[model samples]
Target chain A: MSVLALSVILAFVTPQAGSTPAPTAQSRQAGDAREMTLTLPHALRKGETAWLLVTVGMIGHNQIQLTTQSGKDLGNISPFGIRSGQAAGTYTIPVPAEALSGRRLVLRLSVPQAGGLHRATTTEEVTSVRLVIQRFGNGN
Target chain B: MSIYFETTRRDFLKTSLATAGTAALSRHLALAQAPAKYRRYSVTSQQGQKALVSYAKAIQAMLNLPADHPQNWFRNAFVHLMDCPHGNWWFYVWHRGYLGYFEQTIRTMSGDPNFAMPYWDWSDLAQIPDSMFNDVLTPVASAYERYTKDLQTFTAFIQPSLKNYWGKLSPAQIQQLNIRGYKTFDDMWNDVSGWTPTPMTGHLSHPGHFNPENTAFAPTPIARYLTLQNPQLSDSVKKNVSKGTVYSGLEPTNFATTYYQHIPIANPIKIGFNSSTTASHNTAPSKGTVFSTLEGLPHNSTHNYIGGGAGEGSPIPNGPWGNMTNNLSPVDPIFFLHHSNMDRLWDVWTRKQQALNLPYLPNSQQLPSYEKEPFLFYVDGNGKQVGPSIAKEYISMSRFGYDYEPGYGEEIIGKRNLVLAAKHPTASVEGLMKGNAATLTLSAAAIKTHLDSDTATSLFALVTVPRPTENSPNREFDVLVGAPADATNITADSPYYAGKVAFFCGMMHMSGMTDEATFIVPLPKRKEAFANLSAAAGNVAVTIRAVPSGGGASVLRAVTVQSL
Candidate 1:
């Protein structure tokens, strides 16, 4: 399955309305790669820890790069311990201190191929996800 | 009654002294009041443009002098004086003093004692004045030739100087650059980069640095990118086009009618000078409260729009105007004019507040520690470099021998009737998933009446949320105005699409000061959408959808749909 196809599936399964998040999944296909989407809470509080439940679709090494809209690289998530085609362990992605400056942070996922002819040569493309961190304890 | 009216001789003498003392105090106050020698005129007017041209010429002459000269000091002082007091309580007072000093310097240099700085009223006339864009006042033939020569000389100095500075980069920075395969300073500088240079401090000595013509005032990196891509055009053409893009990107028409109209009179005064108990100061307003509407909406919008892309206008970033970012904005000549108008708006808002018997901080009492707060150091009238002055001394514009054009505030106040449309009850949203939306239904009749009554009719979506903590990440929400069904996937250019409700938390939010944040977006005037609603629905619905760019819990507490 490609990343584009995975994205469509993820959009369909996700809850359409309301602020609360339910366990949801999406997938999209891009070329020969398959990408699965994980839902994050719509809003985050400052200094709060956020977890991403990665569902492994392909057997490869995956990393996540977070950036701003102006393309300022924030930080990266790496060293995933997940097997192909299975639900993976929850990964802890610490929000950086500077990341709390009221600007949207975009997360881009990359899956590097391994052990094949193209081993260590290319990474699977994944759609970027956005995260907004709100001020803590501020009632909406 | 006659017995009561008769006073004892001792009592009469005491009363006479008291009356004489009162008269003397009044006379002293009158004497202390400086004459308004200079009148600030609109940049759009002929007299205004002429005065600006004359002032620019005087500045150019002063720029031609040696670096150590006092006349040259005035030009360099602007760069230094502007580094502090932005995105804080000191934003207005600091600039007010800076402008006052600059005006005096210009007057002295030009030998035109009556010359006052002209203001660019972007809120009213959304376009850059023709004078600034064209060579109407300062003929280009001579100035352009001089500017080209000066630019070459400055570039020669800067390029080699940067190479030296590049060698001095921290070992970590040098290693990172080396890892990126940057072999030389020129190679690093030439790289197509997103990295912004750390702001420079101290005085700039070159004539090119003083002349606006020698430098392109593109504030955003994208504008610079576009200019680099289109190098075939003359520098003048590129500058003009850049200015045009900045003007268009500001979305002036939508701004004046929507965001500008929605700002309550008290907001301009309260945001910077709000008392400790007011909504925008130390304590945040209750959830869903609409406060600091001016500061959070039109004021921030203009800054973001002009400085870069993050507010209304084209969703893309435009080029640089020094007015875009708070720190280096004063370097651009337009900064003074833009700020002059802002100062005027504050005055206008204060006048309106006075009329309504609303409480406000007087100029002298604008900041709590105003009297003791050291602003910036600059050269005084005596040609002596003065130590930092306190905020209280710079509060009154008249004290500096200048005043804005008479009745400037009245003109702005008169436009309020168009903004006085019926506001719908506030709708609260705790959070929203991407593609999900919250809608507020307003009376179609009220909207129609407002549209029919005014040619500048525009719908406004006012979103108010509790102020985010100082370091909280910025969040943005897209608002769509129209019937509910047609509002999906609306582009910024669409009449149904209102602008983004953005929370730029960093400098704007001081730590421990919990103020409410409000965002007002002017919806595009989609006559068809209004017509469709009028044809079928009793109520018009405005929907705010969360864009995928910002993922977090919703900060939105209340949204109001207003017409202007």
Candidate 2:
């Protein structure tokens, strides 16, 4: 094998902490839903705003929700009502002044199945995402 | 049959300069014989600023009139013309017709027969002109109030609610109260939000809402944040402003040289070919190649950078520019100026292509039903309202009596030395696995030298995915340039987060076909990262992996990166 090819192979084999796993063909297949991992800031103080930037493969009629660990809804993503696909945008999520007591937050992304029924229910969806957010003291 | 009209350049000039009498008639006749000679000026120049102010005044006057009145007709035209054929083969041709009619309306209203529209050359100036922000002309607050009263009277006849709305205010009360009038042409153009006096809704003769307070009938939040020279913005915002203000995908130095200079005239692969034989009506080849590297890169990048959302944590965080969006863009006057520059670029590209004896596409191909579609109406030279005419009628600007100022291209291509070290060899890798990374090598010394000299030196990767069928689900891919180990961890916040590729329905469903959907990622600043790579690896390697967007499998056609 060439030096370049060797480097590529070795780069794959040598694993490091927090490294993103290479997506296989099966992971990217249509209808084979996969969980999307977003890299958000570790913690937000009370009354602080964090801009969550998500890159979705398809942005159809979907909704991304942010809430507490026990499922108290913070808010639905704004600039919503997406009609097309392959979209990217920033959503501003704010931690209220009262939420300083919480230690953790969760972001849930719900995308309805393409042609399947049960469009209203979020629990039984084919592709769903949950990202945990760590919290810190209110600085201000 | 092709409508053949020929006139000498001198006659065209005379026709453009002649006033609205018998001389204007003769000039109009001359116009039919050949292309007219109206020079489009840059907005930064003295003449260009003057022309823009004049246009604002004329549009303001039009705004004051009733929606159906002759003066207001031009302002009303934008509502119907937008969100149709942008980002496709017809983008240039349709706008040419749209702007041509608008210029005629301006001449009729302003009475400056020689008046031509000025273009905002963002690629050259890299910022919205200061004149666009500062008040250059005296405020016409009283005149605006008078027009608003006139509009109130006009609309009250159709909608009684407007009569009730206006009954509360007297002329004396109106004069005492500060009614918002345009302080600058930018003030008039920047309001894209919605007009004051709340547009009329129920039982109006016109189909759309009318804004009596502002011309263009739409309100825009004076994009005060758009000025690149403003010092109050944070360093990060300033950086975003600077990068977003200019084309980041290609080096200004080698763009015109390596790409445009090397383009062959007759090569259908570079510039699109005409499949139809109809004289004077060339159709874009249904399958042939189009768009040279330079044109395609700057064109799409400018659209996305400008219209796409402002950076996260920006002063106007996530606020999108109207110029970036398709449907509401025409409402912003900058839309015209930006498009005029785009048209100017097309003109330059055509000239360079023709110099090499390029075979022009038969009538410019348009989206379905738009080939011969009429786009609004405007008052002609004889004071007669004309058009609702097809785009074919306005194909050539000269045919309509205007041309860009001489040497506009050369002026933009002014002395800039090409960084030979910045140029990277074109490399392609097959089977670029989704989420799996592969690296392409580049000369580290070249990257360091380019960055050491120009802090704005950016790395751009052109990711080409095989063209998908019309029904393919939308897919997006993220590209990064750095150490192979760090490739997977690079989020949108990471400096290595170049940008993403979005394959939407509108792009895939467009009439003309592209061999591949080429996405240009303006890689974030990574000079130090590049330096580290150069010290250790002797070369910079760019890694690209498909971010799992759950669409069709992405088949890599080619991937090339260069320092710009």
Candidate 3:
């Protein structure tokens, strides 16, 4: 049994099988989550105004909305009476350069927790950041 | 890849010039021997010669500022967007404005007092020498021969505009921009020109324009390391930057929604052993590299591997990462100062002085219920819980405060689970119920309460069942409490509970008996909360469980009958 102990017993009896594993905690724990897209920051221009950090910290007792698929309500991040054992803070919101054009949008974030017993959503796919509209004296 | 960028560009130019000569010999060696609470300065101890005089006084104060001073177009579009791609956020705001212009030119050469910048060891480039990337006073071996003579001015201006906007790519996206995108040369000269912020020391100098018949060929040694340090980022125009990869930094399971993933503000009581689940080593495939056992890789432990390639089984510069803009990992911006010193040691083991480092049980793997648990961690998908075990989630570590002191070994010791206890030699555990003899209570009688919580609360012993237990198949129960004295305080009145203690037991491996027996116990100690009142007298012991007998100890109706 040598050849480096039969390649460490066939590298612990080989098993690449269908591959794609490694991510568990019961597969990223439930209702499944993993999505990212954040383009907004060219000093954010157009209507020229920026500031929208918004961070609702795992808000669970419900309340955490944000829209714009023409549904517009791009606001409300309450996170209720702070400190229910904190973790979510930082809300700046103000952005309005024609509410930053589009190329695929959706920020949604609702959360309903215990008092309501269930209701969780966390969408975020914001691609809108084109900006090069300068014009003025044509400093190009 | 040129020996992993000649050991990460010669240990990031010799650990940013030996942490700018250990922040100038830790200012005449004092802070009583440099480990924490440090803040000194005075620079001349010449190592990387004050990181080349703090990179020529932060490129002569961002080339003398003015041109519409919004920090001179964010220091001229962050040093011409340090030629894009290294995992975006404008490569972490151009590496927090080039490490805030090398921590303000090392606090204007030490005259500033709050020093502490030191890191770049890049695992001692697995033991140095390759003429440490042909020296040239290191900016990664002069940006690795200026990224191999800016690959013939990026094949004559970003290969005919990235083959006319992304049409000819695969060779794994040009070897993912040469090993995990934006493999530097000031990010492939910001993708062959176009990221355009042309200025030479500040104001707005201009050297811009390109195509002199593709810059009259013949320059190489990476076009003399990009015209000797950015001759206004030329080499012809075409743009599209954003080069961050090696899986692009910070994602230790979102680690409490990223607000400082592993706190190390100056080693505030350090300890970062996430050891990425059980460690081990020796996989080495050599030069295609892959050396496993730092727990078989994936940002190898407590995070940071970014945009990939340790190829042949991988593991090279793998740690102290930062680039592609999650800044901090240019060989250790104390890798975000050792995860903010292991998030302030789980905020000092859950928090103290006012109390509640709670948790004495329930971390469920649910077997024959062999308890000793505590240490939970969830973040989104609605299960909220964020922190509840590092002993009961914070109330003070002097309130997120940070002076950070303690011989810098980055301390970390907390995780023990190995159970079994049974003490009835005399502490008390007599029985014979229904026929009369009730003494099953508890608030704290002997095992002086200290299993620390984040969620599992129980302390039982009660009796009364006229008739149950199908003729006993297993019921060995014993988990009593009370022996207090070393500085006693069971409160609700304590005379060692007047008589009958039995503080530990569990042998009930499942049987179907009768009459009555309830023991869900398993507390042998160390989930921790000791404020040391003369080490709180926790003498007696017990933890045996074999239950299944007599109507399955219906959680012994949560005990509390008193009277001896």
Compute the TM-score of each model's chain A versus the native chain A and list the values: 0.35, 0.37, 0.23
User: Could you give me the TM-score of model 2 versus the true structure?
Assistant: 0.40
B-chain TM-score for every candidate: 0.45, 0.44, 0.25
Model 3 chain B weakest 10-residue run by lDDT: B234-243
C-alpha lDDT (0 to 100) for residue B510 of candidate 1? 60
Model 2 Cα shift for residue B262 (angstroms): 33
Candidate 1: tens digits of C-alpha lDDT, residues B1-564: 000011223453464455445444544554476557777888877768788876777666655554445445323433332233332344456567767777777777777777888887654455445555333122222332332233354345234544554565556445434543455664443321222232224543422122221123222222211121221322211221232222211111111110111122211111112111221211111211211223323343344334432211223322222223333334344556767776665555444333322333433333355445554444554444445467668766766866667433342222212222212222322222233445665577666764563223345455554544556545555444443543345444455544455455444656655455555544444555454565656876545543422444334555555543
The runs of at least 3 residues in candidate 2 whose Cα sits more than 4 Å from the true structure, single-residue gaps closed, are A1-140, B1-36, B77-84, B134-331, B362-384, B406-564
Q: What is the DockQ of candidate 1?
A: 0.03
On residues B1-564, what C-alpha lDDT tens digit does candidate 2 reach at each position?
A: 000112223443353343213333433453465445788888888879889877776666565556445345323343322113322345566667667767776777677777888986654565556565443121212333332224344233323432332344344323322222323323323233223333355646554442311222211332123443641322222232232222221111111111111122211011121111211122211111122222233333333233332322223322333333333344345556767786776665444333222322232232334355444333453434463456557656675777776433532121111111122223322323434454566666656654553223344455566444556444555444453553444444445544445555444445655645655444445553453554555665555544433433334555656554
Interface RMSD for each candidate model? 25.3, 23.3, 28.4
> Over all chains combined, what TM-score does candidate 1 have?
0.40
Which candidate model has the greater TM-score, 2 or 3?
2
Stretches > 4 Å off in candidate 1: A1-140, B1-35, B77-82, B134-328, B362-367, B381-383, B406-449, B452-564
lDDT of each: 0.38, 0.38, 0.25
lDDT of 3 by residue, B43-148 (tens): 2223323433443333334334443332321222322222222211111222222333344343443344344333222211111112222333222333323222
